[model samples]
Target chain A: MSRLLIVDDDRVGVSALAALLEDDGYQVVALTSSAGGLEALSAGGFDAVITDLEMPGLHGLELVRAIRECSPTLPILIVTGYTNSPAAATAVAYGARRVFPKPVPYEDLLAELGAALPH
Target chain B: MPADDLERVYRWGWLPLIGGCVAVTAAMLAASELLFIHYGFADPTRLQRVLHLVRGAVMSFALALFAGWYMLRLRQRVEAARESLRAQQAAFARRAWKTEQAVGLGALCRLLVHEISDPINGLSLHCRLLERAAGRMEPTDAEPVRRIAAQLRDDTERLQGLAASYVEGNRAPGSSERYQDLSLEEIVRAAVAAHPCPEGVEIVVEAASDLAPVHAEPDRLRQLVEYLLRNAIDPPAGSHRVRVSMTNDGNRVLLAVADDGAGFEDPASVFRPFYPASSLRASLGLAIVRDVAREHGGDTRAANREGGGALLSVRLPMGERTS
Candidate 1:
C-alpha cells in the first residue's frame, strides 16, 4: 500500500479526500496546514504528496519546491482551483508531477498518483 | 520626434524675426534723421547736431528693446500652451483608465464567480465521495448514519446547483456555438463590411490567397471579427488607419487587427482581460476575443508592433478549433 500526504486549507476537503483515498486501501496522512504537511513529509515515509495551490501560507508551488529539495524522487501532485493559471505552471516548474483543477475527477487523480509512483 | 521638431524651431527659427525687426527699426531711424536734417529743425551748431543724433539713437534703441520683449513674450506663451496640453493628456489618460475599470466591473463579478465555483465544486466532490463511502459501510449503516448520508447528498446537489447557476450566468463567450469548417477570410470581409470605417479612418485587409479553412462557427467568428474590427478601426485612442490580416501557417489560421494609435501602456496589458479604466468598450471587446479564441483551441496575442500601435491576434488550429 502506497502512503500519501494530502494537504489543503479546506478542513472538510482534506478529510473527505483522505477518507476516500484510505478506503481505496492507501495509507494516508491528511493535514489542513502546510507547516504540518512539510513536517510530515520530512519524517520520511510517504510515497507521494498532494497539495492545494492557493493556501494561507506556503502556497502549493513553494510547498512543492520545499518538498522537492528534500525528496527529489517523490511524486508531487498539485491541485488548484485556478487551472491554466500561471501558478499551476510554476508549481510544475517547481518539480510537481501534475496539476489537477478543483472538483478533480477522483479517477483522474488516482490514475495520476499511480502513474507518478515508482514501479 | 515632435519634441525634437519644437527644439529645432527654438534653436534657429527666431533669427529671421529679429532681423526683420532690426531692419524696420533702422529704416525708421534713417527716415527720422533724414527728416531732421532735411527740414533744418536744429540750429547749425555742433552741439545742437550732436544732441539731435543722440536723441535719434536713444529712440532707435527703445524700438529694438520693444521688439525683443514682444518676441520673448510670444515664445513664453507657446511654452505655456505646450505644458498645458501635456497636463491635459496625462489627466485624460488617468480618467480613461478609471473608466475602463468601471466598465469592467463585469469582469470582477465573473472573477468572483470563478472563485466561488472552485470551493463549491470541491465541496460537491467531497460530498459525492462521502456518499460513496457511506454506502459501503456494512454494519455502520445505522439510522443517524443514513440520515447524515442523505443530508450530504442533498447538500451536495444544492452546492452543485449553486455552482452551475454562477457558471451558467458568467459563461465565457461562444460556449454554445456550433463549429464547422469555414473560410476565416470570408468572415473577416463580412465583419469589415458590416462596420464601415469612419471618414479619415482607413482600413486595410490582407489575406493569403490559399488560406485554409478553420473549424469554427461562422456567426460566432463573425462576432469575434466584428469586435476586433471595431476595437481597431474606431478605437478611443484615435487612429487614422487599421489593418486586418488573415493567414494560415500550415496548421493554424491566424487572424489579427492592428491600429495606428497609442498602443497599450503595457503591451501585455492588451491581453490581460481585466485592468482598471480607460477604453471600456475596447477592453470588453478584447476580453471577448480572448475568451472566444481560447474556446477555439487557441489563444490571443496582444503586442506592440515593431513600428507602432497594437496588434491583437488569435491563432486557431485549422484541423481542430475546439478542445
Candidate 2:
C-alpha cells in the first residue's frame, strides 16, 4: 500500500479527506499543520503528499519548496479551496505534481493520484 | 436693475425697438403726405415737398437697420441654446460611461470571490461523509440519511448555479444570443425547483395564470431570479419565509421576491455594488439583477417590507416573441 501524508489546517477537512483516501486503499497520515507534515516526511517513507494552500507556520508554496528540497522525487499534490489564488499555480511551478481545487470530485483526485504514483 | 427685470429686458427689448422703428417710419410717411397737400399746386414749392420726402426716406433706413440688428441677436440666442444642449449631452455621456466602468469592476470582483472561494466544498465533503455513514446503517435507518445526503447535493448544485451566473455575467451580451421566448411562470418554477430553502426558511411562489413571454437571455434571467431567491432564503436574518410573485400589465412584466430575513441592516445600501464589508456578495448579486433588467429595458427597486423582511421587484418591458 502507498503511504500518503495529508496536510491542512482544517482538522475536520484533513480527517475527512484522509478517510476518503484510506478507504480507496492507501495508508493515509493526516496532519493539521504543515510543520508536522515536514517533520513526518523527513522521518521516512511516504509515496505522496496532499496539502492545502492556506495554513499557519508555513504557506502552501513554502511547504511545497521544503518538501521538494528534502525529497526531490516525491509526488506532491495541492488540494486547496482557493482555486483562483496564484499560489496554487506557484505551487505547481515549484514541482508539485497537481493542484486540485476544493469541491473537486473524489474520482478526479483518485485518478490524478493513481497516475502520479504507481498503485 | 433687478435680476428678473434685466432678463426680461434682454429677451424682449429688441422686439419693442423694432416695432417702434416701424411705427416712426409710418408716422413720417403720413406727415410727408400732409406736407405735399399743404404745398401750393399751381407754382408748387417742390423743394419743401422734397425735404419731407428726404426725412421719410431716412426714417425708413433707420427702421431697416434696427430690423437687421434684431435678426442678428436672434441668431446669437439660438446658437447659444444649441451649445448648451451639446454640453448637457456630453455630460450625460460621461456619467453613463463612468457608471459602466464601476459595474464592470464590481463584476470582476464578484467573479474573483465566486471562483476563488468554493463555498460548496465543505458541503460537498459533508455529503460524502453522510453517504459513507449511511452505508453502515440498517436499510430502514439509511433511507432518511440518504435523503439528507441528497439534500446536501441539492445545496451543492445551488452553489454551482451561483458560479454559473458569474461566468454568464462575464460574457458580453450578444445582440442575438442565448435569448428565448420564455414564460414568466415557467422561469419561476425552474428557479424555485433548484432553490434549497434553509432549515427554517420557507419558499412560496405565486404566478399569474396568464403571463406573457419575455424575450431574454435564459441564463441571465435565471441568474437574476435564483440570486434573489437565494438571498432571501440563505442569510441568517430573523425571518422564516420568502414569497415570490410574478405579475404583469399589458405593456410590462414584473417579478417580486420578498424575504423575511433580517430585513436589510442598511436597506439603503442593499442594491449598491460594494457595501461596507466583504459581505458584498449579496449586494453584487442584486447589482447584477438590476443591470440585467436595465439591459432589457427594465428596472429594479427594493424596499423594507411591512412587519419584517425586504421586498425586491424587477420590471421588464414585454418583449416581442421570436418564436
Clash number for each model: 8, 1
- Model 2's alpha-carbon lDDT is 0.72
What TM-score would every model get versus the actual structure? Answer: 0.44, 0.46
Native contacts conserved, per model: 0.23, 0.25
lDDT of 1 by residue, A43-115 (tens): 8999999998666445466678789898898988887655554456657877888888666667899999888
Worst 10 residues of 1 chain B by lDDT: B103-112
Evaluate candidate 2 by giving its C-alpha RMSD to the native, one decimal.
20.0
Q: What clash count does candidate 1 reach?
A: 8
lDDT tens digits, residue span B136-163, model 2: 9999999999999999888886776666
Docking class of 1: incorrect
DockQ by candidate, in order: 0.11, 0.10
What clash pairs does model 1 have?
Answer: B96-B277, B96-B278, B97-B277, B97-B278, B98-B277, B100-B277, B100-B278, B101-B277
